[model samples]
Target: MKVMGFAGWSGSGKTTLVEQVISVLTARGYAVSLVKHAHHSFDIDHAGKDSWRHRQAGCREVMVSSGQRWSLTRELRGAPEATLDELLDKLGPCDVVLVEGFKRAEIPKIEVHRAVVTEPLLFPEDGRIVAVATDTEVSTTLPTLDINDPEAVADFVVGYLAL
Candidate 1:
């Protein structure tokens, strides 16, 4: 599978661009998977739920199933957070994987930048950034795409990776 990523500072509209990219790419018959990195602790299970109870009861991992869908939750239990490659192994086959974080990872990615923001561009420090999507006009030599237009970004991505 082709692994691509979107990297940016907080509040840079990375999610918005990523969502549109997913919509556009999937509509064109590409099987896309995503891995999003969160900055803080998060919980998908609610208190008093069966899955929650299982974890609280000292279960290392819990698998819940129903007619609609099945999910597996595993507790790290002091184990360090998994690396990008380790997390990617858990996913099934796909044509592309869109990673929202892990900007430091060694993968080709697009740096999303907002016009009003003052944060510096990440491409200068990262060689893996093949292109950039920005809300304003940038003079960098790297290929630039409009952050507001996902179609153009998708087209650029497809051409860049020959997907």
Candidate 2:
């Protein structure tokens, strides 16, 4: 599957843009998947839930299944964090995968930016950035996409990857 990433600082609207782009792509009948990197510890199961209880009881991995859907939660248990490639391998076949972080990963990416964030742009130091999606004007040789226009961003992604 083709892969693209969106990288930016906190409050740069990366999440919002990614969500909107997903909607556009899916509406066009593309099977899209996303892998987001969280900087902090996170939990998908809540206490008192069966899955949470299984995890609390020291299960190495707990999978909850139902008619609608299912999810598997694995406990690293001090194991090293999984790399981006490893995580990508676990996903099923899809037309595209939009990664939400892993800024340093050597994959094509769109650097989402917002002028109000006051942070320096990442494209200068990252060669994998093929474009920039921003709310305000910016200086760069790469293609600049209107952050508010998800359709345009979706078009860029499809055209860039020739999906």
Candidate 3:
């Protein structure tokens, strides 16, 4: 599957841009999937739900399935965190995969930048970054795009991946 990534500092609007891109890409008939990296603890299961109870009861992995959809939740149980490649392998087949975070991974990425964040650019230090989406002007050799224009950015990604 073709994979692309969005990387930026916290509060840089990476998630917003990615959401917009997904909408546009899906409307254009491409099957797309997303993988996001969370820095803190997160839970998709609620405390009283059956799946949650199963997990709390010491199940290493819990899979909840229905006719329309299914979800799988697994506890690492002291194992090392799974790598990007390992996570990607779990995703269903799609025309493209849009990843958020994983800035260190060896994949083509668009650096989302906001001036208020005042963070350093990732493209300068990371060769995997193929483009930049910024709210303000950025000086770089790579292609620079307006962060608000999700369509253009999505186009760039689709073209880059040749989807």
Off by over 4 Å in 3: none
| Model 3: lDDT to the true structure | 0.94
- Segments in model 1 whose C-alpha atoms lie over 4 Å from true places: none
Clash count (model 3, backbone only): 0
Give the count of colliding residue pairs in each prediction: 0, 0, 0
Candidate 2 local lDDT, residue 30: 99
What TM value does model 1 have?
0.94
Tell me the TM-score of each prediction against the true structure. 0.94, 0.98, 0.97
lDDT of 1 by residue, 27-107 (tens): 999999999988887777999998999999999999999999888888988999989999899998988899998889899
Evaluate all candidate structures by whole-model CA lDDT and list the values in order: 0.91, 0.96, 0.94
C-alpha-based local distance difference test score of model 1: 0.91
* Top-lDDT candidate index: 2
Q: Could you tell which candidate, 1 or 3, scores higher by TM-score? A: 3
Task: RMSD for all candidates, in order, please.
Answer: 1.3, 0.7, 0.8
Candidate 1, after superposition: displacement of residue 4 in Å?
0.5
